[model samples]
Target: MNVLIAMDSFKGALSSERAGKALERGILRTSGHQTTVCSVADGGEGSVHALAACVKGEYKTWQCRDAFHQRITVRTLLFKEGESLCCAVEAADIFGLHNCEVSSATAATASTYGLGELLNQLHGHAIHKVLLFLGGTITTDGGLGVLQGLGIRLYDQMGNVLPDDCNPLFAFDHWDEEAFQTVRKKLGDMKLLVGCDVCAPLYGKEGCVLTYSAQKGANAMQMHKLEQQLHLLEQRSARNLMQEGCGAGGGCAAGLHILGAELTFGYELINRYVRLEQRLHTADLVITGEGQMNHQTLQGKLPIRIAQAAKKEGIPVLAVCGQREVDCIALTTYFQGIFTIQQGIYPLHEALAHTEEYLEETGYQLMRLITMTAGISHTVLKNQKVTIAEELCRKGKTI
Candidate 1:
């Protein structure tokens, strides 16, 4: 029996690789099932490193602006195969929240201008495809800054180029006539794919401005203004604004759609890019996890995707996380089990600091249950606390 260990980074805790190795350690200690470790990401943070490690892509750095237009150097990923060229650009690296405090100030000021600049550099790099990793960015500019970086002139009624700011996007009139016609062509048959996790559309109650801007630090007034501006732009743009994933990257994906890019779930694309299915199907069990398991994971997240793939092959999947916040009973139909690694009550900081220790303990505890399944026919409770108690009783260990 093969147990494939493909875990995502625990975020400020353990890396996917480290977490997988730790789980493998415990599994080997109890069950004799073969274990394999695969590092994974959902095209949010740590995507670059995960893809780089797997694909052996060349990393290039360029000086660009952060979310606040501060000068910063960002890395670009290039993966080539024969005549096929794919360049992966992580938007968060250019204009992510980590660059500044997540406050109303950052929300109003952060722009995607630097991402556009990065695209301009790649537009002429003999590239056949561009992969835009669209998560963890601190911009709500709706791709306005990106258009500017792509040389799409945003002009006022007087035909003067507007300033490079999200605020200026509200006043934006018609685009420069000629530049609009040729911008996609200028990209020279390159397919632009925006990889995202969310399916929120461009506007309305379920849209980017309404659902996500607050998380980016938009105050009430700012959300109202941003909503109005986004509504205005979406109306005049004459494109279908009700598309799903338009809300991704703070509506940057919507703007990218206007600029001729296709939208795809980030992990879905990464799975294909990494050829994950072939490895997944051969396994008897798949162990995958991320930092958190909640409503977010229910929405096409990495662990769910792994579970989906494993399910297709009639294999059971177990997801282990640093913490579990929601009742995952609904997830059990897809995943065999969902467990948290926390052994007992500890401060959040201490749990994070010693994530590996908890992970190893949890992994051992998990395999102990799997071992018991073969002999003792005790049912494992779906409730996390009950599961932990049962594991403790089975091992006769006090926490």
Candidate 2:
């Protein structure tokens, strides 16, 4: 039997690829079950690493300015000729701030011009599939910058190009079309896959601007104005017959969606792009986890997605997270087993500090349980295996 282990690391953390590999190797060596590790990322962070592993893409570092115009060398993934199935992009690769300032929403404009620029350059090649990972962005500009970079011009009633700052967001009166011909023609046949979980609209209380502006350091005045601008952008985008993920990367989704991008759950895109189902079907058991396991985990996060796929394959999934919230009953429906790094007794801060040790410990314990269970059910397991194999032989593997 083979076991598959898949997991994603959140932003501000070490890469999950190492952890997935360690788990796969451990289970294989301990239980004699072949193992496959699908290192996955939902485009938040560590996305380039995940993409590189999946598509054999090469990496290049260039000194580019961040959202605040501070200099930094950002790494971009480039694939060999005809090897790219999709481009997995992280928003923070461009919007992440460093020397310019610390958490100033007013200063942190969400202009995906850099990302749009990257995509435009990629368009020069024959590759087409794109996966835009939306997370860790500092802008709340409703993706105006991205659209502008792709050659969509925004102007006011007087026909003046809108100011290039968050302050003048509400001044956008209309879009210029002749400018977008190149991008439109190029991406007419391409697939833009948005890796996002944010379902918020572009404006209002639950909208992207109001909810996210404060986090980026927008004052009350700025927040209100930003919301107004986002509302205008949303109206324009909707009139163009594109909605969904309009709130991602401060509206990066809107730019791409207007250009015919398709929206999918972040983890779903990752699982499909990484070929998780095929791996899950062959696994005897599955392991998935994240920085925290809470209600959000059940809301289209990586762990639940993995568990659901494993359930389809009749393979039980176990999760070991850094911070495990209560409500075992609710979680039981998703995972066969769940554990927090708290070790049954520890402060939240303490548990997080020792997360690596706790995860490794939990992994070893899971191995122990599997070993013990296998020993106890040796005969029953053998009989069940034969029965299953016979059924598969009769009905084929599709069922």
Candidate 3:
């Protein structure tokens, strides 16, 4: 049987390729069943790496700031589609939440300036298109920092320029669009595609601030302030505040929209580049996973997306994760089986460090089950008169 091992990154532990390869090791240990390891992502933290792996692209690293204005090296994917040069950038890598501790202070200060700086460097690359994966960010400044980094000046009511390092969503009264327009003109015919999974609007009851800010470590007061600030920015810019996916990356999507970006589903955008569906067509069984399986998985996480595609093609999919936080019954609609790699309780750090070992063991065990089941089925088909228990004993196997 042809088995496809496609796993998303295990967060801070293993990357998509490394995790898939570890699982591949276990599967091969069980038997020499054909296995293919595919790299996958949901346009979030590890998306650039996944795309690079899929297309055999080269990496270009840029010196940029993190969400907290700390100097960091960010990697971007440089690949070609036909003759057109394309680039893939993951917002999380430059301005991701992982840059700092999740707290009200961090939530209130995070910015996307680093991402903008990276984009500024792309000016003379002659790139035909850019895929900006907008997820896993902590900034809620409505992309003000990004605009600032791109040379758009933000001013307060007093007409004084606001700093780009802090969240200026509230202090933002107006901006100089001349620099923004110049940056746009410099790109010429290059297409900017924003890959985001959420459909939350910019600022409303279900918007970025109220729905996601708390998780980013915003306290109630910070949340209230963020909401009001986002509302003010919305009214000031007169952009469509209720546009689908406007809330992604803490209103970063809406901010990019002002710069002529086309918002698309994160998973689908990556799928188009990776050709996951085309690969699925040839697989008999698919094994996919992520770091965690939770309610959010149903809302279009990478593994669920892979499972949905496999299901549509009548390919059974099994998932193995570091942990399972969602009900199995609900996930059963997409996945035939769900397995967890953790064998015993451990601290979060230890658990993360052992993810590779756990995944390999889980894969080996799962493949063993499949192999034994296939053997039993073959025996039953060959000898209709023999009972299953008798067949097992005859084969010198335990029932």
lDDT top scorer: 3
Q: What shift in Å separates residue 379 of candidate 3 from its native position after superposition?
A: 12
Clashing pairs in 1: none
Per-residue lDDT of 359 in model 1: 80
Q: Best candidate per TM-score, number?
A: 3
What is each predicted model's overall lDDT from 0 to 1? 0.76, 0.62, 0.80
Residue 159 miss distance in model 2 (angstroms): 5.8
Q: Using alpha carbons, what is the TM-score of model 1?
A: 0.86
Cα RMSDs, all models: 4.8, 6.7, 5.0
In model 2, the worst 10-residue window by lDDT is: 390-399
Off by over 4 Å in 2: 22-34, 61-64, 80-88, 96-108, 124-129, 156-160, 165-173, 180-183, 186-191, 197-228, 239-244, 325-332, 343-354, 369-399
Sort order, lDDT high to low: 3, 1, 2
- Evaluated at residue 363, the lDDT of candidate 2 is 68
Q: What does the lDDT come to for candidate 2?
A: 0.62
lDDT of 2 by residue, 281-374 (tens): 5566678888767764554567777777777666667786776677645776786567654566876556546555655666666665565443
Off by over 4 Å in 1: 155-161, 165-174, 327-333, 344-348, 373-399
Q: Note the residue pairs that clash in candidate 2.
A: 105-216, 105-217, 110-139
Better of 1 and 3 by lDDT: 3
Measured on C-alpha atoms, candidate 1 has an lDDT of 0.76
lDDT for each residue of candidate 3 in 196-268, tens digit (9 for 90 to 100): 8566789887688888888788899888878888877777677776787888899999888877789987888
